[model samples]
Target: MRTRFPLILLLNAAGVALFMSWYLPENHGLWSTLDLAIFHFFNQGLSADNLGYAWFLAIINNRAFDGCALLAMGGLMLSFWLKEDPDGRRRIVVIGLVMLLAAVIINQLAQNLIPVTRSSPSVSVPGVHRVRDFIAFSTKDGSRDSFPGDHGMMLLIFASFMLRYFGRRAFLISLVIFVAFAFPRVMIGAHWFTDIAVGSLTAVLIGVPWVLLTPVSDKLIGLFARNLPHFTKMNRAIK
Candidate 1:
């Protein structure tokens, strides 16, 4: 536990430094340029003539599509749950609960801590195409305060937790899913590139290591396992 202190401090420092590097400049530096470039590259696909492309963005950006992402994450989790023994399954459940609880708490704390209320590219950028404009059905195409993307942060937290509890394979797969699902907002102009790359990611970097690297998460999981309802029948059903 003591050995992890240096690494944890390093990661936390890196996260803070990365955030401050961009924040202090107030989006006028290279980060802003990169944000604009990435935004334009993706937003350009939502042209009036490109109905197919526009529809693709609209479909993925819809609220219903979020369920698909959740299902994908759940499916990955189920794969592990089904393979484990009863004891392992219980542990998995504890970890899952911890991951979820930590994600919610940390996300809320980060939002409050980093209160940079900024608009999405669709609202702030000039002459930009919006997914909502292209689709007949409602879709997310903008945000009043887009800093620190909640969606991407949740995905990142899941991936990070997977790395801590599961193995590298789970981590890699979750990381892929994170990238796959988290970028729709950027593609649709609902979020700037920095919203995910800098904001959400920075929070994850700063926050996740502390919970995952130390004994904190393990102790919490153990507490839950001891106090929460036993899953003997639940385990047998799986068997």
Candidate 2:
């Protein structure tokens, strides 16, 4: 079951990419209304003091989250090599590759649903000096057409995996990071409220299946043992 978690994640990610590609831009009215409400809600009492939070949120709403997701994948791969577990490492690498491929395919499909538009000087709302703020505003100008933020999806993916491998603490930390990172996109007009909502949901849809598929520790151990030689060579190269 544990062995299947990565595969499940990949499948779900593919589904989300497909959904976003198929439906978006055409439903801009609904997306705009939702984004406006959420934007105003978060805007209340927001100020420069929470700039750090704003910065993190911006990262999650933008392509920066992609970088973080890739980093997490690298870390997982390194863990397998360090453990000298070839089967384990292979599974992780395979899952990561699948997820990436799905992302590319989905991206291409989504491009047809919503073409990327150039950024204009749009509205400037006070107390929203971040990427999310821009995304929220972009909804009005049609500059922010991406229905779901990929960054949020990746963050959730990382968080879900951490919860499975580590503990509740890791889960909590990842959750906080995910929220923080996602908020800025809405605040700055980079994405609509609906985009964030769907992005987050997309993560859950992918993550739950992954959890169900992955087996517990014992099976993982057996699988690792079976591919020990490959892992050993990889580890030696790392050293």
Q: Which candidate wins on lDDT?
A: 1
- lDDT by residue (tens digit), candidate 1, 1-239: 33388888999999999898888885459999999999989877776789999888888888999999999999999999999997888889889899999999989988999958899989988787777676687788899999899999999999998888788999999999998889999998899989999899999989888898898898999899889877786678889
How does residue 7 of candidate 2 score in lDDT?
A: 75
- Measured by TM-score, the strongest candidate is 1
Q: What TM-score against the true fold does each predicted structure earn?
A: 0.93, 0.47
The list of candidate 2 runs beyond 4 A from truth reads 2-34, 40-144, 206-239
lDDT string, candidate 2, 134-233, tens digits:
3342222214344555555556655665565546775676677677665555565555555556644554565445443555333544555555456557
Q: Relative to the true structure, how large is the alpha-carbon lDDT of every model?
A: 0.89, 0.52
Cα deviation at 162, candidate 1, in Å, is 0.8
Model 2 residue 78 CA deviation in Å: 8.6
